[model samples]
Target: MASTDDNGVAGYDILRAPGASGGTFTQVGTSTTTSFSDTGLTPSTTYRYQVRARDAAGNTSPVSNTAELTTQPGPSSGTCTTVPTVQTQWGTGYVIQPLTITNTGTSTITGWTATFTLPAGHTLSGSWNGTATVSGQTVTIRNVSHNGTLAPGASTTSVGFQATRPNGNTALPSGYTCA
Candidate 1:
């Protein structure tokens, strides 16, 4: 079953064997919906299953009425679609800055990178989880290792260095944009 709220409502599991009462169940993974397939059951074996629903607030409803079926021995395969969305935040510091990257996508996101151009007379002091390169008067942050799978809607934050010269322009940094 699916929760469809995008707030970490994935799927539920059957907690008991056939005809068993007072079984416990749990939620697995983070998504709106989940499906289960009984592919390896012996052809003549009977199986019973139930479903339930959950929300981001950790609330669960009564278990679904049980259903029974026999599995047909065969090969089975299927796929689910997941996408990735991202959000960024620029911090409060004027020169020493922090950027928080959040993945709002339906799928995992990896190897993410962001670039910004420095204003005249401004230079980057240092960076984390990435490399900062400068050419002419522009600075580029590259090779960022967002090594973790931003699972559907996870987030990571990084910080970098910038220096303002005595005659630095008061205008904001260049080439920095957020969606």
Candidate 2:
């Protein structure tokens, strides 16, 4: 799309929502041509996108229609791993000792997230050092700004959470995956 021939159209600005539900859009890139490519995004995560034409004078046209896509899942092997330790427990509640995030790859990592599923009847009561989200039995934990970014062979033990489960249940979480 073009605006009045102020300088003609020079490029397009690309915007993306941080999540799948289109919460909000922020400029993620600029493309001088008709196409753009975004890289280094998290795998299996949904994103919403929009583009607007820009003039040489830096004026922008109305945003184009929204486009949404979900990236394919990353490979099973990643640069990092998250391990939880049990600190304490009671009849119906337990504290997961701080989680340790370790970078096993050769390069520094900007951020990381871990996913796992709790046993039936378990619910997260709270967390620290990381943001936690629970859906049914699945939990997703993401590094906070201050704790992210790790160099090769580095490790951080700042993430943890507490949860409640059925009294006397001995089951623990399984299927841990971090990337």
Candidate 3:
């Protein structure tokens, strides 16, 4: 956002409109920088952005040129792995902590799921930032609305879960497959 007037631009208000021009405009964020990186966007989706410049005197300029962008699909050859670490533990209960899902390929990963095993004696009791479902020893964790998009070489730390550990086994989850 260039200086809209002689007073110089103080900040920027970014608005995004879904689909085409007729859609409703929603203010995305306010930033002092010239560029913004939006995450958690669905792959193969299109969005329209309109930028407005705000002066030091609190005056706003007319909407600038609209920029349209379409996100590319996830990598066909990309690799994603969920690495779990221990955060805390107690009697008959333990936490899987927050796991980092890293995208090792050259393309962005969208709408991801972290698959792992909970071991025989552990059962999921609570979870956050994702949804977890267990079938036998296999656990499938899906990303929430946010934190779903992982850029190339990007690592997102998410999916902390509390599970009942009845067998006193403190080992981390295994079979960490992410997609």
Candidate 4:
């Protein structure tokens, strides 16, 4: 931001507003130079920015024209992976907890789905943190509203399920795939 002040500009107040249509402006930073770097911003979001100049006498100039930008999207589902770990087992049933879903991509992921195959004679009994559906021996789990949207290299352990298997059968689920 540049301003021509008869009293000589002392500094510039950097203001920021969120959204494409613009919102209330707030003082985000002060800069003696012409630029500022805004950090810790959410991925795939829109933000508006403006600047105001302050002179040595403490007089404030009008804000500059709004500048809008939208950040790039985060990692996609193609870079995600899922792993299901057996937590406990009894004679007739077992549990899989902390089914970790990790984003290994370079950006943020909007959502994720995991698919795996349960062995024969096994049935899913319950699940949490994700929606689970069984089609024959194949189980599909999708992230719920809150657990979706992962940043790069981030992981969520909230997905898991409980299942019943044949007595004395120690087989675990296989073919864990994420997208």
Candidate 5:
């Protein structure tokens, strides 16, 4: 497996078998701090691994002390769970309500779709990167793609939206909780 370290430098690989030759190796995934994935191997076969480190200056460090493990039978599957909480704030205006979504989950979030529905009597004046639809008294912003994966503890900010309501009333969206 190839991995990236905390500084975003990306030149690391793990040799899964020390004495075994010609084992196919490939990168699984990358993030700021870590990368991991299961590789295809013979069931019940013992494998050794050695991790090597690299720096931005093109300098490579010695491989880590070798470690050993045995591959289990068949392919393994795992689930990525959503973070329990997200941080949010209300901007000054409907058009300026900037929402920041964070991923506090144990696994990386490959993407996120956020939907915001404006309250009654409100219409969306402008929005960025989000599709806005007005139906009756509700204005819905849907499927705003953040474009990049949000790693654990990572946050991304959505573009602002302008909203107009009667009598200068601030229109807050219902069911606007983030997590």
Candidate 6:
């Protein structure tokens, strides 16, 4: 929360693992403040979280203590779907496709995620408009502060990324599921 030049933390990075074990940890997001609430989590499921601090100059500290979260059980209040559109393509690397997320539920939704499997030889590098992270071949895209909320009735938002692809395989990612 405090920002200073002397051993000061400029931001924080939070990571999560499904349930308490077995699943690997993945970077969920980076926040300029101290407190963060991870979004796009399953209802009535357990999650493990760890955070690290980053300085103004981009130096990151070691992982902090781990915490667990168990969301309350309920019929999830919202529905969403994502369609990946090719934004650009080139040799070896292509600008990450923009994923369009549409809100189909009746109520207003606060946050969402677009999960997909990276194609063979494609690797995620960075993104804009949300947090983009890859674990193995699975890519998880989560909402940042500004673009999280969506009104009902086909409200749509998008996130884009940068990745490398096979020279001939400039195709976009497939099998995207919104949550």
Candidate whose lDDT is highest? 4
Per-residue CA lDDT of model 5 for 1-179, tens digit only, reads: 22344444556655565334456443333323556564566776776666666566555556678667776653212122222122232344444445555665667665554555667766667766556666775544443555336677776655456666666565565554332
- 72 in model 3: Cα distance from truth in Å? 16
Q: Which has the better lDDT: candidate 2, or candidate 4? A: 4
Which tens-of-lDDT digit does each residue in 140-173 have in candidate 4? Answer: 9989999898999999998889999999998889
- TM-scores, in order shown? 0.39, 0.59, 0.55, 0.57, 0.40, 0.56
Q: Poorest 10 consecutive residues of model 4 by lDDT?
A: 1-10
Residue 96 local lDDT, model 6: 54
The digit string of per-residue lDDT tens for model 1 on 1-179 reads: 34444565444544334333444433323335566654445654565666676766666657788777766543112112212122222332244445545555566554344555665655555566656677866655543555334565555555455444444345455555322
The prediction achieving the highest TM-score against the true structure is: 2
Go through the candidates in order and give each one's C-alpha lDDT: 0.49, 0.87, 0.81, 0.89, 0.53, 0.80
List model 3 lDDT by residue over 68-176, tens digit each.
9998975445678888888888878888767887888788767678888887788888888998888998988888878877789888786788888776666656888
User: Considering summed lDDT, which 10 consecutive residues are worst modelled in model 5?
Assistant: 75-84
Residue runs of model 2 more than 4 Å from their true location after superposition: 1-78
Q: List the residue pairs that clash in candidate 3.
A: none
Residues 130-177, model 2: lDDT tens digits: 999998899999889988888888888988899899999978788888
Local distance difference test, candidate 2 = 0.87
How high is the lDDT of residue 7 in model 2? 87
Instruction: For residue 46, give model 4's deviation from the true position in Å.
Output: 22
Task: Please report, as a residue range, the 10-residue window in candidate 6 with the lowest summed lDDT.
Answer: 1-10
Ranking by lDDT: 4, 2, 3, 6, 5, 1
In model 5, what is the error at residue 86, expressed in angstroms?
17
Candidate 2 TM-score over all chains jointly: 0.59
* lDDT over C-alpha atoms for residue 58 of model 6: 74
After TM-score superposition, the amount by which residue 132's alpha carbon in candidate 4 deviates from its true location, in angstroms, is 0.8
- Say which prediction, candidate 4 or candidate 5, comes out ahead on lDDT: 4
Model 1 misplacement above 4 A: 1-94, 143-148, 177-179
- What does the lDDT come to for candidate 6? 0.80
